[model samples]
Target: MSQKQKILIAIAGPTAIGKTALAIEVARYFNTEIISADSRQFFKEMSIGTAKPNPQELAQAKHHFIDSHSIKDDFSVGNFEKQAIACLGKIFENHDVTVMVGGSGLYVNAVLYGFDELPKASDALRAQLNERLKTEGIELLQEELKNLDPDYYAEVDVYNPQRIIRALEVCLSTGKTFSSFRNKQHKERDFDIILIGLNTDRELLYSRINQRVDLMIKDGLVEEVRALQAYQHLNALKTVGYSEIFRHLNKEWTLSEAIEKLKQNTRNFAKRQITWFKKNEGIIWFEPTETQQIIDFIKEKLITTTK
Candidate 1:
């Protein structure tokens, strides 16, 4: 197949929606490899907490970007976009279709549409914002951002102070709306994209999330966090599972309380992921449990797209 014949299948949805299993099955069906779009799973230190594919699944299909880097290294979405593009290109050489799967909406978008390079924020401004975030609390900056850029405030992760501070820093440094830089015009790709989304009932999805969090704890998530505690300050480490436990280690909260927070935060993360993926018009949504329906849909898409 030439560039025009190449097909890219994007498996996206909320966490615990059975993306990993379905993606592997799809890859096996197409005799293709998998490219992960989950940002958290990219770090080598994060396994149980990130819900990496088990050994059996790994053996079932060739996977990329799993445990490929450390948190100590700075890996941005731009880097992910470039690397994923190259990997997709090479995989397409021998395979007609490649499967990219994860719930990380931003990372998914980065590969589908090359992200724009924003003007760098001044060091002085970033330092000031960082100090304010530490002293004044994230709520203060979140309130300010709500006032300054309501659009961004509406969509951003409010609990993540780093995101709030980074948005504000860019706004203050560039004298432009942080949301303005996000107005992207899609870049054409060499292949045709076929987006397959998986969804579940809200109640069921939340239950699955809580159960998964409990499973992570049982799988030594705490020990994993303990091993990486020295690098807690790194941006890559500032995520739901690790950050909540970091609070416990710092004595900010009790172990039990941190675990509760992790469960709640994971549920919230899933809700946000659904909301983000829902807004993307390109996604073809399906109930995850409907395996036969999904397979038939994909086969139909391939026939129509490749013809």
Candidate 2:
């Protein structure tokens, strides 16, 4: 095998764009393995909402980091960066390339660009942030982030109060901009990278997201949420689908409205993911339907690496 054959194919795009299927097919064709970059899918309790690959897909090709942890486990992007790189190192021992597919822009970049080496928050700082969150609410923190770092404020998930608080706490407690430690020099990797971006029309993509949420409900997402409701304040629990349902359970929103918001928020997330990935210069954009063409392109790239 040559340098191109040792390529790391990264499949990323908006949610529900068929990245999993494409990744599986590509992995099978190359007789290689897959490393999931989907951050939500790491929580063992979030199978349905994360759209984790079914057992058949797992049996067809080896996958790493899917349903690998519980919501109780405090997994971070930094931790994922370490584990994913280690997993890829093992996979590279046999196959030239490994497929990493997901829509989580930060997690994907955590693997590709490496995370910032910021100081870990102390327990006291966390407790302070949590207390402020309870008393002052996320709106106050959002305002602080807007004033502290307006660039990140527009890009960050405002609805996710926990993330907002964390960013602000990092700035206020440490006297450093949260975004200050991001997008540093790319760490050199052993294998070449091939970034495959999937795309579709906005209306069609939103429809897919709505339908996926409905499917999750049918697959027992509500029960999963009920089981984890006691830990709702945890950062793991402050996500799109489950957070909205928690509001309904709190009588803050009707069940119907919560479901609606879940769908709407998921759609918005997909939009943000697309915006983030489009700005990445390395990715080659393709329609999900063009699987064979992508495969052939990869094959040619591999051939070029041999020369």
Q: Could you say which candidate leads in lDDT?
A: 1
Estimate, for each residue in 1-307, the C-alpha lDDT of model 1 and write its tens digit: 6787798899999889999999998898889999999988999888988899988999999999998888888888789999999999899888998999998877898888777777788889989998887789767998999988887776566666777777898888877778888736877888888999999889999999889988998999889999889998788888889989989888999989999999898888887788778878989999888777877888899899988
Alpha carbon lDDT of each predicted model: 0.87, 0.85
Per-residue error (Å), model 1, residue 207 = 0.6
The worst-scoring run of ten residues by lDDT in candidate 2 lies at: 1-10
Write the residue-wise lDDT of candidate 2 on 200-274 in tens digits: 889988998999999988998888888888988877778888889889888899978989999998888887788
CA error at residue 120 for candidate 2, angstroms: 5.1
Q: Give the TM-score of candidate 2.
A: 0.91
Task: Mark the regions of model 1 whose C-alpha exceeds 4 Å error after superposition.
Answer: 159-161
Write down the lDDT that model 1 would get. 0.87
State TM-scores per candidate.
0.95, 0.91
